[model samples]
Every structure is written in structure tokens, then in C-alpha cells.
Target: MLIELKNVKKYYRTGKLNVKALDGVDLSVEGGEFLAIMGPSGSGKSTLLNIIGCLDKPTEGEYILNGKNVERLNDDELSEIRNNYIGFVFQTFHLLPEYDALFNVEIPLIYRGISARERKERAEAALEAVGLKERMKHKPLELSGGEQQRVAIARALVQEPLLILADEPTGALDSKTGNSIMELFCRLNEEKNLTIILVTHDEKMARYGKRVVHILDGRIESITLN
Candidate 1:
């Protein structure tokens, strides 16, 4: 299994009241699987994605990622796991406005202390993979919404991560653009065998996944195969 969450629970104490974000959620994902998590606002789908991406720790239960127990890892270890094994794409295209597409995609490798030459090479390859090679020098402000999202996707792919966690990646795009972005994800999942777990509220988007997991009240309501 690429990811295994057993009886995972996440709680937040707001003043005195406790908020349960995830309640006894258990999920398993194999490598190369395209899974979509569907839920409305406040459904804990984002929180679940956060935990799986190593951005947050569960309040209770075990999270095994790539055969390693994530709950037992220290902060630095967790950071390493996130940097080396996981890539994240958000609804907002969080690209640096000042930088061009190439530089934006090179940001992750820069943190890893990769050499400039290698970073450029990998970033170029990733951009090409996402059909953004022609716009490598375009700044976020100069690109369209879909193009900016493509840049974000390229940034995520530049690291060649084992898993990609996308939180409503196409939320900001129009229907046509959104479908194109989803098509790109499908191509990556099929061609590169990259494991992807996407979170979206749209049924149309969820159907693109091989399996759909419905979450509600901080828990998985159902799992359906596409």
C-alpha cells in the first residue's frame, strides 16, 4: 500500500469546545491509483488531505505512508517525507508573481539544494510534461488561469514525488479549463504511474478518478468505483 490510515482522528480545541475534523477515518491507497475525495465545505476532506500530505498530524491513530509510520516521525523527518515523497497542489495557484514559470517550478529543488543546472533541466522537463514548455518564461500575471494552474502542476511534478495531493485543483477554472486540467492529471497518472489523491466537491470531477470517496461530518460516507 502507498498510504494507510487506520482509525485516524483529528480534533481541534477552540477555546473549550472540541472540534472533530476527522472521526475514525480509515483509508488505504495503492501505488498508481487515482482517488478522488468528494465533500462539501467543512467536511474535513482538506484536513484529511493535510494529514496525508504530512502538513498536519492526526490527533489519534496511525498513518502509514509508503510503508513508514508517519505518526512516529519527528518534525524534520516529516519535513523530509513531505519534500521527498509528496507534492501538493491547491485550488489557488500559489505561484510567485515576480517569477516566471521555470523559476516557479524550480522552487522545490532549490530547497533541496539541488544544483542550478540540474534544477533548470528538471523544471524544463516538468513544464514540458504539462504542456507549458512554450510558456516557461511567462510570469503568472501574464498567463491565463488555466496556464497558472498548469504552472502549479509543473511545480508539483518537478519533484517527481511518489504521491500528489491536489485540493480542488480546478476550482478556480471554468468548466472547459477544468476538464482540460483534469485530463492532464489523468495523463500523468496513466503515463508516469504517479499516485494522485484529488479532493473536489464536483461530481463531474470525482467521476474522473478510478474510485471516489465521499466524506461527510469528518468521516468517509461511502466509496464508489468509477
Candidate 2:
């Protein structure tokens, strides 16, 4: 398994009340699987994604990613895992407005202290993979919504991460643009055998995954195979 979450729970203490963001959630994902997590607002889907992505640790339970038990890892350890193994795509493109696509895509590698020559090459290849090679020199404001998202995807891919966690990746786009973005995801999953966990409320978007996991009230309510 690429990911395993056993009886995971995340709770936040808000004065006298404890909010259960995830309650005894159990989920396992095999390598190269495209899984969608569907949920309504305040349903804990984003919190679940956050845990899986190592952006936050569960309050209790086991989380094993690529064979390492990560729930109890130190802050630096978790940061290393995030930098070396995982990629994240958010609803907001989160691109640097001042930089061009190529530079934005090179940011991760720069943090890793990779050579400038190699970073440029890898960023170029990633942009090509996302069908945005021609826009490599364009700034975020110069691109359309779909194009900006493509740049974000390229930035994620530049690391060649084992897993990609996309939180409402298509939420900011029009239906047609969203469909195109999802199709791009499909192509990447098929062509690169990339493992993708997409969190979205849209059923149309969830259907693109090989398996759909529906979450409600901090628990998984159903799992369906496409």
C-alpha cells in the first residue's frame, strides 16, 4: 500500500468543546490509484486531505505513507516528507505573481538546493507534461484560470512526488475548464502511473477517479469503485 490510515482521528479543542475533524477514519490506497474524497461543506474532507498530505498530524492513530509511520514524526521530519515525497494542489493556484511559470515550477527544486541547470531542465519537462511548455515564460496573471492551474500542476509534478494531494482543484474554474483540468489529471494518472487523491464536493469531478470515497461528519460513509 502507498498509504494507510488506521483509525485516524483529528480533534481540536475549542474552549469547552472538542471538534472532531476526523473520527476513527480508516483508509488504504494502493500505488497508482486515483481516489476521490467527496464531502459537503464542514464535512472534514479538507481536514482528511490535510492529514494524508502531512500538512497536519492526526490527534490519534496511525498514518503510514510509503512504508514510514509518519504520525509521530518531528516537525522537521514531516517537512522533509512533504518536500521530498508529496505534492499538493490547492483550489487557489498559489503561484507567485512576480515570477514566470518556469520559475514558479522551479521553486521546490530550489529549496532542495538542486543545481540551477538541472532545475530548469526538470521544470521544463514538467511544464511540457502538463501541456504548458509554451506558457513557461508567462506570469500567473498572463494566463487563464485553466492555464494557471496547469502551472500549479506542473509545479507539483516537478518534484516527481509519490503522491499528489489536490484539494478542490477544479473548484475555481468553469465547468468546461474544470472538465479539461480533470481530463489532464486522468492523462497524468494513466501516462505516469501517478497516485492522486482528489478532494472535491462535485460528483462530476469525483467520477474521474478509479474509486470514490464519500465522507460525512468526520467519517467515511461509503466507498464505490468506478
Candidate 3:
């Protein structure tokens, strides 16, 4: 299993009241699986994604990622897991506006202490895989919304992570563009055998996945094969 969450709960203390973001949620994802997480706003889908991505810790329960118990790892260990095993794509293309596509994609490799030559090679390959090789020198401001999202995808790909977490990846794009992005994700899953878990509220987007997991009230409401 690429991911496993058992009885996970996340609660926040807002002043005196407690906000339950995830209430005893359990989910399992396998390698090469493309899963969609769908729910209305405030449904805790994002929280589940965050915890799976190692961005947040659960208030209770165990999270096993790639056979390792995440709850047993320290902060630095978790950071290493995130850097070496997981990749992320956000709804907003968070590429640096000042940098070109190549450099933006190279940032993650830089953090890994990879040499400049290897970084450029891997980043360029990733960009080409996403059909952005021609725009590698363009700044974020010069690219279209879809192109920016492609760059973000390339950044995620540069890590060659076993698991990719996408949070509303196509939320800002038009229907056509969003479909293209979803198609790209499908292709990646089919070609590379990578595990992909994406969170979205759109029914159309959720349909692109091989399986759809519906979340509500911070729990897994249902799971269906698409």
C-alpha cells in the first residue's frame, strides 16, 4: 500500500471550541492507483490530503505511508519522507513568477543537494514529459494558466515520487484545460505506475479517476469505482 490511514482524527482548538476537521477517517491507496477525493467545502478532504502528504499530523490514529508508520517518525524524518517519497501539486500554480519554468522545476532538486547538472537534466526531462520543454525559459507571467499548471506538475514529477498529492489541481482552469490536466494525470499513472491522490469538488474532475472516494463531515462517506 502506498498510503493507509486508520481511525485518523484531526481537531483544532479555536479559542475554546474544538473544530473537528477529520473524524476517524480511514483510507487506503495502492501503487499505480489514481484516486479522487471529493466533497463539499469544509468536508475535510483537504485535511486528509494534508495529513497524507505529511504536511499535518493527525490528532489521533495511525498513518502508515509506504509501509512506514508516520506517527513514529520525528519532524525531520517526516520531512525526509515528504521530500524523498511524496510530491505535491496545488490548485494555485505556486511557481515563482521571477523564475523561468526550468528553474522553478529545479527548485526541489536544489533542496535535495543534487548537483546543478543533474538538476537541469531531470527538470528538463520532467518538463518535456509534461509538454513544456518549449516553454522552459518562459516566466510564470508569460505562460497561460494551463501552462503554469503544467509547470507545477513538472515540479512534482521532478522528484519521481512514489506518491503524488494534488489539491484542487484544476480548480482555476477552464473546462477544456482542466480535462487536459486530468488526462495528463491519467497518462502518468498508466505509464509510470505512480500513486496519485487528488482532491476536488467537481464531479467532472472526480470522474477522471479510476476510483472516487467521497468525503463528508471529515469521514469517508463512500467509495466507488469509476
Of the candidates shown, which would achieve the greatest lDDT relative to the real structure? 1
The TM-scores, one per candidate, come to 0.99, 0.99, 0.99
lDDT of 2 by residue, 30-87 (tens): 9999999999999999999999989999999999999999966899999999999899
Q: How do the candidates rank by lDDT, highest first?
A: 1, 2, 3
Q: How close is candidate 3 to the true structure, as a TM-score?
A: 0.99
- Residues 1-226 of candidate 3: C-alpha lDDT, one tens digit per residue: 7788999999999999999999999888989999999999999989999999999999999999989999899999999999999899999999999999999999999999999999999999999999999999999999999999999999999999998899999999999999999999999999998889999999999999999999998988999999
Model 3 score (lDDT): 0.95
lDDT score for residue 171 of model 1: 95
> In model 3, which runs have C-alpha deviations exceeding 4 angstroms?
none
Clashing pairs in 3: none
